[model samples]
Target: MRAAAAEHGLTLDDERDLTPYLDLRRPRDRFIAALVGAGRPLPLRGEYWRMLRGGDALQWCLLNGLLNYRVLYFRPAAG
Candidate 1:
């Protein structure tokens, strides 16, 4: 990707760098609500986060340990 961008004489910055500006209004409000209501991370998915914030936002929250995610493992048993 860097090579491709360089070929076109374009300089690129990582999208992650821009994540800090993501609409944290919801996240902040929710975080406070969670503290007051449950005292835990509001359990949600990246999709919902995106819908609430916007594309490419909230990544910093996740990366910076301000948020977290879950991994679901499944198996098709005895195929």
Candidate 2:
């Protein structure tokens, strides 16, 4: 992930530089803080966290479905 970000000229110095501005006590809090610091509007209450979690779940399901389909339909035949 870090390599990919770096490839796009993006830096991930959260551990040292942005840690002071972030609340590292909780994952959700840190994520929200980073978004706000980057000038992004935050969602009300826990909505941001919920939405992120839901998106992750959906992505996982899609990737799993694709992998299963590939295995079933595109596998190489054994001699």
Candidate 3:
């Protein structure tokens, strides 16, 4: 895995950084992945950013957690 990432100019300096990749093998991640796949009904990427921009106070904590998780773990594909 590290070799593949390095080939793509990505560095895995910490094992914890692989949590998202590992989590992505689970059912929930599969569902999310499929939902965000090309031509899927959900525009998950846009929705996430939009929600972060104007989400209500009721969802503040959840949104904040999502933001933190995304920042700390999510790694978009390279090229």
Candidate 4:
């Protein structure tokens, strides 16, 4: 990705340098901070935390749905 961006004369900043501004301790904290800062309702705070910590699979599904996914197939791993 760096190479691809460099080809177009665009330099991407490393994320490590922005940790202080970006880190909110956890996903839940970030969500709460954003919602509260925007003066939005807090009723969904717990729900947001649950959805985030649910698992990668659930997170993927949530993101996919938000992006208007049409169809998805899932198969359990063989034991």
Candidate 5:
């Protein structure tokens, strides 16, 4: 996996930092993947951002969590 990432110019200095994200890529998260594959929005957990955005899954997930929550429950996803 490290070699694959390195080929793409992605550095994996901390294993823990990316392991969880990789888990999200597996069959266990198949439902979410299927939803996105079908062009449907997820239920505001922001796990999808990790796939869409490159930097720090932790950070994107944090901000997107709240944003998705607000978008789903209170308003549209974007203005």
Candidate 6:
């Protein structure tokens, strides 16, 4: 991902420094990958930003539903 971002003149170093704005879950990475695939800028809170930036209220609701599910059922348990 870093290499790909660099090819486009975007420095992934920003990501490292912005980690505190992220959700600290693997699914957040998936969401960022989705946004990158869509040719959008990386959001400040990653998936949370994506949902907030949805084209309509319905899309926002749907993405939030999915994110809720991931948080409830898929996020790894803390060790």
To one decimal, what is the Cα RMSD in angstroms of model 3 from the true structure?
13.9
lDDT (Cα, 0-100) at 66 in candidate 2? 35
Model 2 misses residue 65 by how many Å?
A: 0.4
Tell me, by lDDT, which candidate is best: 1
lDDT of each residue in 1-79, candidate 1, tens digit only: 5566566555554323444454544776566544434523566556655354442235446656666543333333332
TM-score winner between 5 and 6, please give it.
5
1-79: candidate 3 lDDT, tens digit per residue: 6667667677654444332442223565444444444334545457774443343322344434453232232344465
**CA deviation > 4 Å runs, candidate 4:** 11-16, 26-50, 54-79
Give a tens-digit lDDT track for model 4, residues 1-79. Answer: 5566566555554323222243333676556545454544444457655554444334344445532323222233233
Task: Please report how far candidate 5 places residue 36 from its true position, in Å.
Answer: 0.7
lDDT at position 68, candidate 5:
25
Q: How many times do residue backbones clash in model 1? A: 0
TM-scores for every candidate against the unseen true structure: 0.24, 0.27, 0.25, 0.24, 0.21, 0.19
Residues 5-44 of candidate 5: C-alpha lDDT, one tens digit per residue:
5565555444332233333344534555454555435444
User: Which residue pairs in model 2 clash with each other?
Assistant: none
The reply for model 6, stretches above 4 Å from the true place, is: 1-25, 40-79
Question: Which candidate should be chosen as best, given TM-score against the real structure?
Answer: 2
The sequence of per-residue lDDT tens digits that candidate 2 reaches over residues 19-49 is 2342233666456545554543545357766
Supply every candidate's count of residue pairs whose N, Cα or C atoms clash at under 3 angstroms. 0, 0, 0, 0, 0, 0
lDDT of each candidate versus the true structure = 0.48, 0.46, 0.44, 0.45, 0.42, 0.45
1 or 6, greater by lDDT: 1
